[model samples]
Target: EKKDKKDKKEKKRSREENGAAPKCADEKPAKETRVEGAQAAGDVAARKAFLKEHRMTMEGNGVETFFPCYTFAEAKFPAQANEAIQNYAKPTPIQAVSWPVIRAGRDIIGVAETGSGKTMGFALPSLPHILGAKQKLPKVVVLAPTRELAMQTSVEYERLKVNQVCLYGGAPKGDQIKALRTNPDVVIATPGRLIDLCDSGLCDLSQVSYAVLDEADRMLDTGFEEPVRKILGMVNKKRQMLMFTATWPDSVERLASSFLRDPIKLTVGSTELTANVRVKQTVEMIQQYDKDKRLLALLKEYKVGDNSRVIIFVLYKKDAPKVEGLLKGRGYTVGALHGDSSQAMREATIAQFRKGEIPIMVATDVAARGLDIDDIEHVINYSMPLTIEDYIHRIGRTARAGKTGTAHSFFMHPADKNLGWHTAKVLRDAGQPVPPELEKYGPPAVKQVEKTCNISEMAPAPKITFDDSDSD
Candidate 1:
C-alpha cells in the first residue's frame, strides 16, 4: 500500500507537469497581431497583467500549461506548412496538442473550450495529411454543429489553400460537388448537407480515414446528434476521430467513449471557465424595459472603435436581425448571421468582418459556434445565451489568436439572474474576477424559453477582400 501510494503521487505530479492544454489562433484573414490574454469583463487591469506575464513566460519558456509553440515540421506536416507557421509566430495551444494526435492518425476527444485554439489545433494538422501526394480519396471529413462553424473551418482550410471542399445547407451544393471533383483531400461540412450528399451518392466518404467534430458539445445541444450519427455511419469506422468542445458535458463524454478508442481524454479549464477568463465581463442590473437602453449605454461607455471588431450574441435568432437593424439605424456599420441565413451570405458576413470592412456584428447563436475572425475586441451578450455552452462559444469569438478581448453580458429580470451568476462563477473558478454585481444578483430559478424554430436568417453581403491559391 505504501509503495502504491507513492507511485500514485508521482504519477499525479507527472500528469500535472505534462498535461498542458491545447490553444489556437483566430482566422484573422488580415495581417493582425495575435491576441494574448482574454478581455477583462471585470478586472481589466489584472487580466492584462496576467496576459503580459503569461506572454513573457510563453516567449521565454516556449511552453504553457494550456499552450505550447510547435513547428509544422515537428508535426510531420508537408513543407508548405512551414511557410504558414513562419507567417505566424507559433502554434497556439490547440495546435500543439491536437496537431500531434491528428497527425499520428489517432482518434482524439479534445475538451478544451473556445479560444483555446481548438479550430487551428485540428485544422493545421489535418489538412496536410489529407492533401498528401497522389490519390488521397477525401481522406478527411469535418462535421460542425452549425453553418457558421462549418463555413469558418472551410474558410481557414481555404486560407491554408489546401485542396478541400465545403458542403452545407442554404446554398445549392452543385459548386461543392464540382469542388469535390478536384479530388479534395479534405471535406469541411455540416452534418445536414453531408448526410444529403451521402444519401444522394454525390460524394463518397467511404474512403475517409480521419474525422473531426468541431464544437461537439454544441452539436449535441443544438440537436445535431441524429445527423452526426448518420454521418458517422457513412465514414470508415477505422478512421481517426477527433471530438472537441468548449466543455465536456456528460453527453459529450458518452459520444467520445463510443467514437474514440483508447483515446486521450484532454480536459482544459472547465467549459464555463475557458471562455469567461479572457472576457472582460460586466453586468448592470436593469429593468426589463430598460434592457435595450442599458445595452446601448454599455456599448457607448465601452465604445469599441472603428478599428476593432465586435460580435453581439443573443438567445433568439429573431433578435439577431432585429438588433442588426437597430444598430444599423443607429449608424453602426453592422451585419447579422444566423441559421436562417443562406450559406453564401454567412460566408460573406464573416469575410466582411475579417477584412475590417464591417467592424460591428450582431447575431444569435450562429456566431457562437466557431466563427473564427481575429481581433474581436468585444463580445456583447445582448441577452443571456440559452445555455452555458452557448455562452462559452459566444464570447470565445474575442480574445482569439493570442489577442486580448472584452465580453459583457447584461442582466435584467430576476428570473434571468442565474445566467449572469453562473457566468461569473465560471470566471471566478478560473481565477478570474467576478464583479460585485454578480453577488448582488444571487442565485436564480430557471425561466422557460419560447419555442422557436432553430433556423434563423442571415444578412446579405458586399464583396470581400480574401482570395485563395488553387492547385494547377
Candidate 2:
C-alpha cells in the first residue's frame, strides 16, 4: 500500500509538471487551489497591461485569461510566426490582439476596420489547432460571402503550408470534389456551395473542429444568414467559433448569441460605420451624363505610373462590363469582375491586375469585402452605392497596409440626395471635406416653407376692383 501511494503521487506530480491536470482524487484539490491562487493574483494584472498596451477594448467573460502579443514569435504557430516576421514584417493591430485570444482556444467576435489584416488575425491562430489533426473530414471550415474571398483565403492558408480546399459556387465541382477526397486540413467555401456539397455527401462537417465566419456582417447582408445558420448546425457542437466583421450590427449580435458560446468580443477600433483614415476621400458633384468624362479625368490624374492600380466601383454587375469597355475604348488597359464573369475569367483578371499587367479593374460590390491587394492607388466610385455601408467598403479597396490612397466619388444632385446625409456623416468622421451642396442635404438643415394667408377671410374685393375696371 505504501509503494502504490508513492507511485500515484509521482504520477500526479508528473502530470502537474507537464501542464496537465492532476487526475488523482487526493491531489486534485491541492492542484485546483494552487491554480486558483496563481490565476487570482497574476492573470488580471497581465491582461490589463496587455490590453492597455494594445489599445484594445475587450468585453466578455474570462477575457483576462488570454494574452496579447507584440510579435508573432509569441503566438502559437512558430512556422507562421516566422513567415509573418519574414514576409509581412510585423503584426497589425487586429492580429496583435486577436491572435492571442484565438490561440488560447476562445471563441471571439473580432470587429476591426477593413484592410486591417483581419485574415491573418484569424488564419495564423487557427493553423496550430488544425494543422496536424487526423480526420476524414476537414478540421477547419472558413465560410466567406463571395467566391473571390474564398479563393483569397485559400491562398493565405496555402502560404502557411496548411493544405486547404476551396469550395465556391463559380468553380467546377468535379475539381473541388477531387480535392476534397484528399482530406484537406482546411475548407474555405461560400455558404451555398458548401451547403450543397454537404447535402450531397461530397463534403462533411461532422468532424470540423474550427469554424470561422469571415465578413460576418456582409454575409448577413448578402442573404447568407439562413445558410450560415444551417451550416453551423451541421458542424460539430464542440467547435471553436471565430466571427469577423468590419461593422457590428444588431443582426451580428443575434447571430453570435445563437451560435457562439460565451464569445469574447474584441473590437480593435470604433464599432461605428467609418472608413479607414488613410484613405483620402473626395466627392465631386456632377451631372449623371458627365460621369464618364469625370472618370477619365480622375483616372489620368490618379493612374500615372505603370505600377499604379485603380478600381472603379459601379452599382450594378451589368455596369462593370460597360465601364470596362468604355475605359478600353479610351486607350486604358482595364478588366471587369462581377458575379456573371466565369471563374477562369475572373481569376485571370485578378491575376493580371495584381501583376500590374492590367492597371485598372471595374467591379461591383462583390470585390469590395475580402479583396486584399496591397499598393492599390485609387478607388473611383463611378456611381454611388445603394448603402453607406457599401460605400465604406468600396473605398476600402485602396489605402491598405498603412499606405495612403484616394477615393473619388461622383455624386449627382437630386439623384444622390437621399444618400447625402449618411455620406456626409462618413466623410466628416473620416476627416474629409464634405461638399457644400451635399452638406445642404445633411441633417440639422430645415427647409423653409412658404406660408399662405387665407384668401376667403381676407378683403379680396378691394384688390379685384382694379382688375375688373381694366377688364371692362
Best by TM-score: 2
lDDT of 1 by residue, 185-212 (tens): 8888888888888788888888777788
Scored by CA lDDT, what does every candidate get? 0.66, 0.79
lDDT of 2 by residue, 1-472 (tens): 9999999889879989999875755453453322111233456555555555544577765555555565555554656546544767667877776776676577888887778888888888777667567676788999999888898888888778877899989777999999989888899999999999999998889888889989888776538878998998898899999989888865456545667776778876566788888899999999988988888888887754467899999999989988989988988988898989888999999999888889999999889986889879999999898888889888988988878899999998777777899899888988999999887874646566444332222222221111112332
Against the true structure, what is each candidate's TM-score?
0.74, 0.83
Clashes of each: 25, 0
Clashing pairs in 2: none
Worst lDDT run of 10 residues, candidate 1, spans: 56-65
